[model samples]
Target: MASESDGQGRLPTGIPWSSPTVRVVLLSTVLAPLGVPLISPALPTIRDVLALTDAQASLLVDRVGRRRVLIPSLFAFSLLGAAVALGPPYWVVLAVRVVQGTAAAALFITTVTLIGDTFEGVRRNTVLGVNVAVLSAGAAVYPLVGGALAAVSWNAPFAVYLVGLPVAVLAYRVLPEPAGERERRSVSYLRNVVSALPAREAAALYGSAFLIELLLFGAALTAVPFLLDGTYDLPAVLIGAVVTLTEVASVVTSALNGGFSRRVSNHGIIAAGFGIVGGGLVAAWWAPTLGVLVAATAALGAGWGTVLPSLDAGVSEGVETRFRAGALSFRNSTTFLGRALGPWLFTTLVVGRGYRPLLLVAGGCALAFVPVVLLLGRRG
Candidate 1:
């Protein structure tokens, strides 16, 4: 039997860059966020062509299973995502998107679950880190690609969703159903999953996942654009460049995640990441110069890089094998809920108050949450 350290190296153990499973999973991870970001630059055109309300136009951007689950979900994700380019009526496009959102959810959940099922120990942490890094890279690139495509046609970006088809086909050919998956579905599956987790620990993990996204979006990503525009008087291009720094820093940090996890407890990394995010947000609240804000946001991204992968790996590691998917699915739900709610929270809280106060509140909340993470981590 191989020790967990069997393939340890400076980079990470068993990266398997050329492995079909690795390629397919990483590529699928890359596609996960394309649903919204890739079409973002074209939103105005889409709205104009369809004569949609600003609220209605914003619906396009938003936040998925296994083999039998994987193939159909991927195909649905591809078709529905691509169908938006057909110049359908507003309602029709929205309907397709709603269904596509389901497929997208399946894709997201399944990818994480697949990793939990496939890898173990530090290797799993590293792979999850790489998956996140790939996601950050894709996120960084997609907006630029979408902008370029939007220049050609408002619909061109939608075609990028079709990339899912090839990946689906590749998955069918190469991805294996993990051993014992057939045994996973039992009459007691739900009960077992629920009972597998200690109540407080689960709360801490899920709550932290939700809180991080809430603050990341509400205080940082959502408000930073307006802040840069109004306060700094920066050009849209410059603001975008500044925003990209977060993902750039995220990519660098996440690529090193396995190494960090090997040294720190997942909970410790998560707690520290949260603190770092708080510090970044506090810095953003106080930033007097463009350079300072840029650096602050980059620090925030570094915290993001560390926390997300660790949260994912932590959830996966804590649950019993039989209950892993269930646990991860719950975590995914919280994560998406947080992402969806963050902007809303920001809007609601910061409407008359201003972005600075929201950043302070959100940062303070994140820092306050740190002790909770430490407590849960210690108990677990």
Candidate 2:
């Protein structure tokens, strides 16, 4: 096998911004998160215009049932993107959104897999960090764009899905199939790959990924909105600003991830991420004012920024090339699963006990992982 640092060196051809490889991979990162928050600002308008129940409207960007099905998921995502723009009947829109969730799943898994397949070693780490940063940037932008478009027409936000078509085109042109794609898909081959991995270490990484996302989507994104609305009585604009601040922190941290990885062990970085997130969540739970809330969220964002790339790099390093895609896809699935479960699980746990306790639970969940990660690092 060709080494990542062989004569070709680590950098792919072309300038970073102008390169097709970077552009396609970065653009692909946008699609999944774009589906997540793009419709959020328009939900009220959609409910009013389409006469939808809250349950029906919430389905628009719900992450349920979107894992594992790769190629078909992208096709479904593009089609649903177009379909949702038509403002069809409520049932049709609901169905389209559910399927769109699956497509988002496909985009997420394929993009990560492509990154692992295309790059190696430090370059791989750098690209993964860039991908995570871009994802955070996209998450930050979606609500703002959705709000602006919603001001024009509720249907306008759905048009953002059209961005998928061009991204799909770019992906097809730039992404090469993995070298041993055929064997990677076989049931027995996959079993062998799974058997080859360091089970405890791999589990630690995947578990950390799931827990970090749960803190992100469940506690930070989902719970913070309610806290702002119910406790702070903040306006929509202020809430949006807070969310954007978190994403900004994440973007900055992710951009620094490559350098951070060079200085710290992956396990140390992962532990720090959990520590930061746990502390932030605890702060948010106790925060008496909006300023504190913003600071806490920034901490959470920073932790997430650190966690994602480190986890991706660790997992990629652990698996061989032939099984890399499957490993990545499984990791992606855990992320999506965390997103899907975060709100529901947190909400369920928060009932009766209230949000403060829920925040504690979320924060504690992250902190608990710190030792597990540390142990793994020592073993590795």
Per TM-score, the best of the predicted structures is 1
Pull out the clashing pairs in model 1: 64-105, 64-106, 64-107, 64-108, 64-109, 64-110, 65-110
Q: Which digits, one per residue and each the tens of the lDDT, describe model 2 over residues 1-380?
A: 21434366554322256556567777778777878678888998998998888877877777661112334455578768777777678888777777777767677776776666666665666777889899989989888888899999988888777767766665566555556665536788668667655878777888888888888988878888888889889898888888788898989888777777667877788899999999999999888888888899889999999888888888778887677777877788788788778888878888778788788777887888888889877763
TM-scores, all candidates, are: 0.93, 0.89
How high a TM-score does candidate 1 get? 0.93
Root-mean-square deviation of every model: 2.6, 3.3
Candidate 1 overall lDDT versus native? 0.82
lDDT of 1 by residue, 4-108 (tens): 343553333667686677787887888887877788878888888778888888887744236777778888889888987877788888888888888888877
- Leading candidate by lDDT: 1
